[model samples]
Target chain A: MNKPKHKKLTCLGIESTAHTFGSSLVSLDEENQGTIISDSRSVYQPPPGSGIHPREAYQHHSDVCSGVLIESLRKAKMDMDSVDVIAYAGGPGLGPCLRVGAVVARSLAAYYHKPIIAANHAIGHIELACMLTRATNPIVLLVSGGHTAILAFSNGRWRFFGETLDITIGQLLDQFGRAAGYASPSGAIIERCASKSEEYLLLPYTLKGNDPSFSGMLTSAKRLLSSGKNMDDICFSIQETAFSNLCEVTERALAFTEHDEVLLTGGVAANTRLQEMLTEMCRSRGSTFRVIPRQFSGDCGAQIAWVGLLSYLHGMRLDISKSIVRQSWRLDQVDILWRH
Target chain B: METLIRKGAEADIYKVRWNGLLAIKKIRLPKGYRQPSLDAELRKRRTIHEATLISAAKLAGVNSPLLYYLDKSNYSIYMEHFDGPRIKDVLDDPDLGTTKIFEAVGRSIGSLHREDIIHGDLTTSNFILISDGCLGIIDFGLSFRSNRLEDKAVDLHLVKQTLESAHSAVADEMFTDLIDGYRSISGDESTNRIKSVMRQVQRRGRYARSV
Candidate 1:
């Protein structure tokens, strides 16, 4: 299949999927190659042990949106009139945060007389990873603070083969870390501490026939941490079990899809051990494994902007009047038959 | 020419182009929750207050965006724009692996607070990693001029909280570098205030949890 000739389109993307409120600008050329001129992100750190509040997150977004958006455009050396489309993560996030993004997206589209492209934040992440690494027909393992899913893309659509049955991988890490007297979003700290220790304790590994249960494992890890076990040991066990479960599900997805490529995305993918394990598993299976660099792994607006350019080139546009933020919009809900 | 970008709970930011250079226009957005006439009066006063603070920081040899324009009628102020990554992203990178960056962050923040500027939001996002490797603090929206030790301590406390919550793996090393830099710039007395503030914040956090 010949690659489609890409035209130059400038897209502004807004991302507020979890705790980060980010904006970026992407300019795609005729070869479908792109340059991310500017990207700025503002993260809202909730008080320790507090779940992310929607209203507060929204207020944070509103607080920083102007500076972030302007910085992105200034870096791109473009004006609002020069922007071709406005893209935003539309769902599966805090409702108030999503509303802030949606309101800005709709407002920008209306003001610029441009099209709005409401993107599936998760899919946008995977697509950006694919574009960056040039991976094809891969089993995508998306593990972030809020989501954990195994997706297979083929025949022009992505299919969800398996996912977390309860809490996401990052959430598990955070919960266990907090229980251990650490702060929230503790994946990196746990990984760092685990790297220091050598002994591995047995943590619960819940692989209940293709579906993974992280809450149970989290509880088990919490119990071990509270039981006066070594903190490093608990961290190691949890990391090992989580990575193993992910590898198991990923391997199953590859077998089911018969795909030779596996790509890892999301914040947890930044963990060196997880990447190495996934890579080793794929190598053992005689399959290819790819991961985007750490900078591109998390929820960043650059990914959204890049995908937004692609959608614009493909003539996928949203009606500004009807476009609204959806907190639970699924990736598969949109029909791509027209493109084919 | 200044262009509107967005309005927040406390301020507004704009994209301004001046003499072939891009800049940011910030204004204190009005808060209606306060007494109506008082809100308007406060908004007007804050625009001047923030602009004066930015200028003062610039005069103090700090690497802040340059102030170019101000219009109190609309609560608007313009300053030079920076085109660079945020310090948060720089620290987030596993490859960069440099402690100096954090030191620079700490020193810049220290200088600001020492000069009586309390950055209400001290998250890594509020600063930028300019091309020259220097750090520039942006978004004075939540910032105010204060000489109180509690405010300076709160600033340090917020930075610590941010590191622990967002960048936990390197939180200890990064925050240490920050303190070292802050101490060198802000003097021993200021550092003591920061330490005391840190204790107070932690105790408060613990007390709130227990309650």
Candidate 2:
């Protein structure tokens, strides 16, 4: 395949999809491949034992928007004028949070006369991993608070082969953590607790075809907790059961598609246990397994910036008048024109 | 003598000579991703459930493969082997593809649904084009008995989803013909009801509807 040639370009990416407000600077080389020059972020912490309030996260993003952007500019040693395009996560996120980022990107694009791009939050996660891992045409398993889907690129778009029927894997972990008196975004802590136990209390394994439902498993885990079951065991059981469900559906997609590679990304991709399960599945099938680095697995500006670069090269431009936020945009709806 | 034919998601299917007759033996393979106990239970339950579903589908007038034998101890099912191409492989081929086959596919599924049988996995990969040019359903690992309109719709949605995902070029034409065939058996009223319910079922999917 011939590589598309393009002049060097720089893009500033803004991400305020959920709890974290991030800004990043990315520039393309002569080969048209993107490189992240700088990424700066400020995450909001909700009160312990409670989940994020969209209004509060929006406020948090509003407060730190300029600071994050300025830090990214400073780290990259370039000012906003140096950026040829401005990109923001447009949808599949908190409405208020998405608005904050859109506002920032719109203002920047209008002031600097730069092209604005609306990037899908989920696609950002997938593209960043693909760029970093050099995985072409692989089955992607995206697991995060906002999404849990097994996807593959087909017919100019990413198609979902499997997904969660109810709550996402990330929400299941975080909700479980909150019930244990911990704050939201408790995946790391849950992993720690889960690793400390070997007892596997059987939970409801709900696999409806390629779709896995976690609400039942979540309910079962909560019931076990209230019934005085060991917290460690409960956490262990939840992780084992939930991750196994994800792996099973993903494996089915793999076998069905006959893809030779698998890419694991999104916030929940940081979990070592889930990673190990995916790795094992891929190994047994003789397929290559790629996981995004922990630092880049979650929501980040670089993801948007990279996708923005790709989109921009493919002539994607959102006029300032049309720069709007979409809270429920789906990943599959995005046309991947940049890819062959 | 047995020869491995396909390694499916939950099972390994082998072509075997059972009593000097051609047959297919499906063995549910243990998934390393799952706990040993959980894996064992799921494999056992699905093996028996598949056999039961196949028998039910046959009784419902659907042309599924005939069951030859079932072994619960090792989670295997031996059934009649059809030396035909999977519908998925020939659905879009000019010489092999035909709207008549998809219509037949829809009718078979309509019959199953009329009997309150849901073929939980309804992708074209499970449909075989036998020598006589009939669509024979196979691999009922996920099938179950459900009278709910929602369950039936979901089963159809899976087929639609697969067609769009894997056979985008001919998906729309195939789906229309398939639905037409479905309407012939299920009637326009029930088909319309199911289609509406199928829309709801489709919307219930994560990020399904654009807001």
Candidate 3:
């Protein structure tokens, strides 16, 4: 216990996916993995309903670039040169947003003569979630604006246990928020609105085995709102229908995975209402429910850095040539070389 | 006479006495994984919705159980106790005929779809044989109001898929009889409207399985 098995690997992680552009520097536990030395992030929130203007997001990243990176180094209180590698969210994000992180990491790797690691943004969310929660072999419910999927880690990578057939849950919620006169990234507000009303409006409860569809539910919620349904009631009904669908599909996945832990990650994990539903589902199955704390739940650089370090430790590719941002990378496409 | 009858993910059912009358009680079990407030609301709402759906299915000409009482506080319902074997138990019975039961299964589902009511979980187990050899639809936990052909097709698809996976030998004959009953009850127009949608669903199912 006195000595660790492998030497610590220090890395700098940059995340510029969607509306968040930030950086973090961490020294990972080389043996057991995922020991965070330091973490930091900065998010760019636009007006409600106008989410992530790709060009504007890129400009925002460039505008606040130096401060975020400097803060991350300051947070770590480590010499910049001591970092062994530069890792960035490489794909599964807006091209312009992803390019910012890729270019930054590429230049840093070039300047430092170190390797560059390109990791999937979605997988970054799951990896950081698993690390922070310390959930081994857990079903990952990665729900964010750009993605919503039920992923199970197996063999060496995450596979789709089930995912959205139409729009992501985040989009589902945001659309309802917009229709109800809220701004973009309005999950928190929607949750509060839902809490205020207890009325249950009939909405489409679409579930095809483990997969689910929210397009119908979202449409119905909007129609009900316009027809003079109470705003709070519509909000409440939307969450009830949409979240219950999530719980049902997740329960099916749990039945298949038969794992003891369910890890909730991504931006929407902030909703306590959602946490409650998932918590109850897990408890019913005698399983554990773990979520990334509020601070780390959203898009964060620390998660990217830590995930890159894990993959790098396991001999994953580190070439800047092929680190292009993949706008729609599926989780199953990535070979999760780190986990056995 | 309280005797345990059935239990499922959302609720528990018991053959119990209601006002000294033999009735079935459906109590929505508290899910510990849910937040207390959300759980209570869901239990209350679903109990009421299920009870409402049961009656609507009956009005739509399906022989659903008669609802006797609604106890909102405990999130329970008292309904007429159906006597006879569950359709699942007699799905492939050698001595007992199964075609008529399958036809009734189709008609019950058709009746619900005809009224824009989707029986969320439409499986053989949710159907029971009554004393007169008629099929009674039970359990509306997942039922909802959606007139979309897609939703209706999905409902029919669930029944077909459940039978195919659970009762392979009789799956073909049962499905044929079920469709005949659905077409006769729902009429060719509405049934035809769902055929394309049903095909799309089957294709999606195949795609999901292949990958």
Candidate 4:
């Protein structure tokens, strides 16, 4: 059961879904929309070629969550007792990492006698972007290592206008980056490398009916790398092929939803190349385009904090006992009560 | 000069005179959101790819618009334009018989899948009923080359679901006849694969809901 709606509320949210653990404090701005007060994050960077080990990331979260929480409160200029409610990324993430955040959030909730809310990580990204950009029911192009979908909010639900049929563009790029001996989260570096490329290598293009498949193209790109192909050209090809597929899908979704605007979110949304492609698509379609700020584009606790604020305003709740983390929560499963 | 017929998110379809012939030009536009260098490459690549898929689909015995000219520099492809009612509108008309139309659509798609060419967009609107009564497939914008059974099955899945939502009145009849027509050209192995994968895709959709 949900508590009575709270118009002016301050919520603290915890996020430890993957390699990062952090806490965020959110409050309503003058426009009556959720805005981040402060966000504190500590990422677990793995050694080259080793990639992130889930167990290690969880341990990192456990060790840093408290410090992050303290810093978040300090930045918000509030003490523990000033928080109204507590929330965390409850599902649709790595299990061990998610558990760390859930445990810390529950402890903070009980200590402060505040209601606990379980927030969907995917919806959190959309809500935070909407709050900051004031976008009303625009088509959301979510591209991340864990997610790739063209989502539209309608009738209090997130509808999938199109999605990735196979591996996501983010994973593909990251894999390419790893193969190139770059560190994890190598999207930016790869983008930079791609910028220097003028030649194009033939790779499989698999954008199908607004959905995309990246495994084939990824395979080809990796093969090119192994055969000592030009790294810049390969990176350029990956961006050209994959981002085009993403825009193709988003464009189709725009036509189907007839939404006058598009909001690009998630970690992959931080890519400048993707932004330009999506912006170009939007401009041609006579629609407005908004990209979440780079700071908020990637996974973070601030998004969850803002979404929790919105959910609390919409009469939603998560009992402390029932706050188990879900590792495979999809965006469509959320009811989206906060949006009209 | 070209007169715009329809503008889609990915590309623009324009009616143009190609060497004094009535040709339709599909131009893959540059995405300003992407870097100009990458955007230019993407549009050029898609323009060429679509042109190739058109021929592949035709080689597989499907009736489709013929590609007459291609300009990679401007990212444009000139092709024959069929002046006919879209299959969607015909299916929507109660006075028209859709069984024959659906049968043709099924066979046309069956040949495409057999050739490892996924139409990507299988909606009825993408198929047009030309003057010869043969269904012409258009808009290979999202198409790709994939022989994998899963990809083919997803194509069928899209078709069935699109009809279910958009042509609710005749969804069952259309799908049943489609399968029947599909069986006429495709081998049992392909159809069997489609059946199994279609179930999996649908189940995945349902399971995702519970999560």
Candidate 5:
């Protein structure tokens, strides 16, 4: 749909798909360019040596939802009346976590009499990165705790060319880190440890066609750690093998689509080593590579707010009763109404 | 004389002269991104594996490029080149009677499955429509011997995904014809089993819960 002349809209988005409860405000001006007004989030830290418990994560989101929302609006120096739409991450995540965000958004919409939008978490990541990086069409390598897929837009939807057949890259790092007595979500620490060693251990590099399976590699890494292998060397080898598998699949997608740009998004996009490797690969093949800024690379409310604004502008208005969380929603199943 | 033709993710294809014949040479290039030892091992293994699968595919009565030579040390393979359009480029052409072509594809895949061969990559791009109007399969780099029903289902699922994603305009008609052709060779019982398994495979994707 063509934008009405000089039309402007503001959206407030909530994200509680996992451990983080985030809120942000985005404003779209007459030019259809979106500006993030404010972004605030509170992340729940699980007990040491344990993964996130879904119930505890839900409680964390419920406790922090209002505070994060208020902080978002306060930082923007705007109130709820200024927001033209309310949006929340609706699916493809933990059901309990998603419910908290959806409930909050629904409650706000009811109180304020504002229209609501149910945004797909994965699409939020992609659209926000695309807007920030100015990539119109590109092969997307979405890597995170819950996802690892090489995708491209075709036939009005994101189509997966390849993905992890088992555990994701993020899970691989987190589980390995936990095996070494670190808490979950230990990608940063793993990266730090990996950088200190140059040794490479040969682990199973499983690539069934374009799809990569990391479960076997994770088991092997744990075995190495138990057998008294140096943690740093194992970390180094895991990163080397896993990142290479990712890049190889991405390269294959690039060859098939011949897209001039490649966009890296999601939580694991924060890894500098991955960014470097992807950049080098793209350079060798004459394609532009862009990573979402480090701060915005991970789960954030800004992505939800930005995509929410797009959905609003495209005339998507979900009734509060009909607006519910879909825990099993897939990215490719979402329609791209805002994009051609 | 040799001239480069296509640079694939795992290998580079070249149009070359082999013993006064027009042939193709596929060389698995060393990836700079992977560790040197890992890269060397992967390239060598895939080069040999592709050669083996290609010969096996022909023995199973599948139409594939004829092998001329295998250069193990160089991670290269020399084979007869059949110049034609990729099936991806022409599957939807209304004038081509595309249903029969898709049926042929299914028949070929059914035969491969019967021989316990799983073509890990089954995209339309890997199929070539040769001069004699016969369907030719290429790229056996990911092919493997598998008797598992899951493996066979995955092969079928990949073809469905490719058609839906890259050739949506005529996917419905094409897929129906493909299943019919496949059933003619595989019989109704195994086809039904494979179809059910393929449904499970589709649902097993991340965030794709079974309903």
Candidate 6:
């Protein structure tokens, strides 16, 4: 979608959500035409049972920040000065990790005299996924290490219909996997094991009204494992319960929002079972199901860069002196406080 | 004329009138140990970062004070002046006896955490009971987006610690209410994360005590 007579705006985006430290340079022209010129990512996977420390993640950011920036720019075939804006994940992240990204972004903004845009990491992922598949007004099921919510895009904002009550789907997967002596952040491994296990063990499934109780299920699974149950069966059972709960929530949210399309985003969106279940749910309802490619599904900077460009197009320029790193910033909080 | 409202380790807050509207100014102090140039750069960056975060949270439908201005060169943030009692103040006063207040605070915190933004220091003091009775989170200078269980757990731990330290008499009750409220917004996964992290926090606490 290349066009002439439109001023091309280039953006450099940085993402530091969880274990991934990512940077991407995207170029958007007039009429919102965009292209991802370069993207680089670094992941820090700690050993099993050893959780990700905020300070350690921050250090990881510090170690990879320069390289990621340099590589993204090189891939984009542009220099730092050519970047029209700098965007970074603002909050719903680790404090130290967010600080590192913010510091780098601010420094770059200062050095280049470019406006800085801060985006909510989750919203960034959602928008990018939606844009990738051209999906609109879909039922969104976001499941990651930190979040599990059924959302719908309406009234110019995402309306949340249902979500987990205790632990995030990804977190539950990781914790259960770790307890079962798997690697750290055991989403992929658990998915693999669950695929192999044939028997389904009965676990606690507490559906409280519209909300699903994951903590109860996790506790039940842990107890079952501790009481000499099959680890493989428990893993498979937990995945099934979590995915089933998510699917039920998504169906309810879809019915409540009265939307047909379902778009899934987040790290755990990569699970084949979740994808299969969601696809089936959508198919049964004659609705559409969309999942962005795995790279974009997880944390990345392209969406941040794109959203930053949208803000710029809307004339929301940052007062260079007024930019700061926020560890807990949210997307809805933007309109209340920020004025152009 | 401006009045000094409050002071913390990192900032001195001032109540000022802007165009006949009330505003709060958070000014960062220069660090002594850091080189002058580095400190100035650091202060300017931090001031902007905090202001940006406040604006971001406001956009996400989270209750936070509006950011009026950021004087990054001077390391100061002027935000919509909120006139309300801090949640901590409300919780500490036995006469208030607002049992439902804890639930409200918990929901607000839970909503924030659900959005993946953890208030690094989730003390009751960080929230203001607005005139509308809605709890507004303040001081996003230490906020961040994280999907890690440990990070989220630490945020809850901070809140738990705050309750134990400042609201001990009703700490257990308040914590339960908060979790209940948090569950209402965050759903079951958040509760599970909290339970897991809380267990870890307790274990760590025990280890610390033994050491």
Output the lDDT of residue B184, model 6.
Answer: 89
lDDT of 5 at B52: 91
DockQ, each predicted model: 0.01, 0.66, 0.10, 0.29, 0.63, 0.01
Report per-candidate TM-score of chain A alone: 0.94, 0.98, 0.95, 0.96, 0.98, 0.93
Q: Which candidate, 2 or 3, has the higher TM-score?
A: 2
Which CAPRI quality tier does the interface of model 1 achieve?
incorrect
User: Residue by residue across A246-287, what tens digits does model 2's lDDT show?
Assistant: 888888888888888999999999999999999999898899
Model 1 misplaced stretches (Cα beyond 4 Å):
A1-6, A336-340, B1-211
List ranges where model 6 is wrong by over 4 Å: A1-6, A334-340, B1-211
Comparing to the true complex, what docking class would candidate 5 get? medium
- Candidate 6 is graded, for docking, as incorrect
Tens-place lDDT per residue, model 1, A165-245, is 567898898888777767667889999988988676655655433447788888888887777888887787788778877
Score candidate 2 by DockQ: 0.66
Angstrom error at residue B142, model 4: 5.0
Tens-digit lDDT string for candidate 6 (A1-340): 2223448898888888678788998887666666788888888777767778888888888999899888888877889878888988877678888878788899988877888988777777777777678776677788788677666543345534444656778778888887888776898888888787968775665543244668888888889989998777777788776776677667655653456888999889888888887787677667899998887777777877867766665667667566656655444334311111
TM-score of chain B of each: 0.80, 0.95, 0.91, 0.89, 0.94, 0.89
True contacts kept of each: 0.00, 0.53, 0.10, 0.36, 0.46, 0.00
Residue B89 deviation, candidate 4, in Å? Answer: 8.7
Residues B22-134, candidate 4: write the lDDT tens digits.
98998887666555665676677667778989888889999878999888678888999888888777877876554567778888889998888988788777888886557
Q: For each predicted model, how many residue pairs clash, with residues at least 3 apart or on different chains? A: 2, 0, 7, 9, 0, 48
Ranking by DockQ: 2, 5, 4, 3, 6, 1
Q: What is the total number of backbone clashes in candidate 2?
A: 0
Q: Which portions of model 5 show Cα errors greater than 4 Å?
A: A1-6, B92-97
* Per-candidate local distance difference test: 0.74, 0.88, 0.78, 0.80, 0.88, 0.72
**TM-score of predicted structure 1:** 0.60
